[model samples]
Target: MGKPGFERAHHVAFFDAMATELPGDYDKQEVNHLTLSYFALGGLSLLRELDRVNKDEIARWVLSFQVHPEAHTDVDSGLFYGFCGSRSTQFPLSNVKDPCHNGSHLASTYSALAILKIVGYDLANVDSKALLQSMKKLQQPDGSFMPIHIGAETDLRFVYCAAAICSMLDDWTGMDKLKAKEYILNCQSYDGGFGMVPGSESHGGGTFCAVAALHLMGFIQVDLASNLNDSASIDMRMLLEWCLQRQVNDGGFQGRRNKASDTCYAFWVGGVLKIIGAYHLIDRCALREFLLTCQSPYGGFTKFPFDRIPDIYHSYYGLAALSLLEEEGLEPLSVELGILSSAL
Candidate 1:
């Protein structure tokens, strides 16, 4: 078959639905509204149609999630001043009086800043001091970051989020690069792929987080052999080989060993390969064909070709992966920040 046509109208409609009203199944994702918004807004950016959305209104809505230190002067004051995932995550305002239950999340904060940039908002108005202060508190002694200040998981995903936040803000004071590098190095599995934490199974998403975080922090060396002996050094060659191995014969990538190929891995794994300067080694034509198969006739993309419906996550990554492949009519993506290159 010929290359599948990009159903722009259908994809636009899909993003519109996500931006306006989510389906009933998305009830569980109510707390992650910011992330969902990022997917929709980011996808529109990739489609070069971000102007279709209300930039000002969306920017204001995103800013509302910012937890100001002055406003939240309770015991957990400075700790929760970044940005909440959604309004539902805000205490007092959401009638959630439990101070411990409501707080800013690293991932949400990253998405908020990314969407703001995507919508053409200037970061000068953002309280970078407050945001960075809150961000610093999320980092543990080992350099891994918890999604939130209290009782949250510490993993490579949050580490990437933290790095992206600092990179966008053009400030490194928010995190310790040496410690973060040590943590990332520790998370590398023997097989060369990275995991969520030390000694965990290697995963595509985690690998992207580790590699992208290093890239954003300026720790990635162009000369792979230059940093081999350093305590926090990454085995660039081995990691690149592991990422390359993720691509199956059909052109799609799997998250882990012996798993079925999925659409999102195109970004997760592809992003890693691009960071390591090994993207040229992948079968670009076959990967594109595999992603096209996952494209829904109605709109967006599913995790796999047979999935009945498409969600925002896979849909956005599908577009991003296509962008990495230099697909026609798509915006080029910043592999490290996971945003459109124009946004930077």
Candidate 2:
């Protein structure tokens, strides 16, 4: 393919189709249907075409995934009352708090709240008391968050979700800001990039999670790019170097060093630069050309330029990356909260 265009119409139809029903290719993602739906709805938001979907109906469906405590005191039963990922994981509204069985997830809760916000639903209307109270329990002594209530991985991804949730709700009671900040600082590698956890290799996604979470939590006082001297917690200069280096020759970004350029990192790494106010330094023309090559003719975007089929995750990020470039006819993306500004 010789430079396939943005295919805005096809991309619109792609997200529009995904909003209603998922194809069989996403069978493994049934558990993450809400998150998947977020990609579609959020994708549409970035494209300035949210009116294509039914906001009220989608809001009702999203709310149904929220797990509720049967009693007010049950919030202390060590169970998370956030939204479950999907119907299959959702048990019949139980406060059981089984270490073996729990439905609600940090990522799912983030997606559900994000979807609600995207569709113009009032976050004040949500059951904040139970959700926030239990969300606190998900934070570990180290300040990283487990996606689920108990016995799950704790890393920067869930940390970003937690930060986004609290910021969206306009409340920080769900987590301790200083503690989360410490955990995030610990994840930053000597190279100035952040890993998913301490001692891991630096990655683009982890870097974004750490940086964006810190920004949402109000840890990055003022544009660090222009005022790096005041920063003591993170190596701002090294971080900026690490991020700018991610943009490969193809103009797309790779999640890590020595990896091939990917579509998602265009958003993952691109988002970090945007948040730090260094987005102006990248090769925008080269990046857009690379992203256009990844756009699927049928609809959506692929991870690589040569791939023909497109997935929802990469497709959403590709559009988001383009939004950062200020592409014509797209809504501005908030690189911090992982949702479009139009949604907020």
Off by over 4 Å in 2: 94-101
**Predicted candidate 1 versus true structure: per-residue lDDT over 1-344, tens digit per residue:** 57777677888888877777778787799888899889988998898887788999999999998877655465335465788897767775455466565568888999999999999899888999877866777789999998887767899999999999999998988898889999999999999999999999999999999989998898775444443433146777678789899999878999998999999999999988887667888999899989988899879999997576898889999989989999888899998998888889
RMSD of each: 2.3, 1.7
Range of the 10 consecutive residues with the lowest summed lDDT in candidate 2: 93-102
The C-alpha lDDT values of all candidates are 0.86, 0.88
Error of 1 at 51 (Å): 1.6
Cα-based TM-score, every candidate: 0.93, 0.96
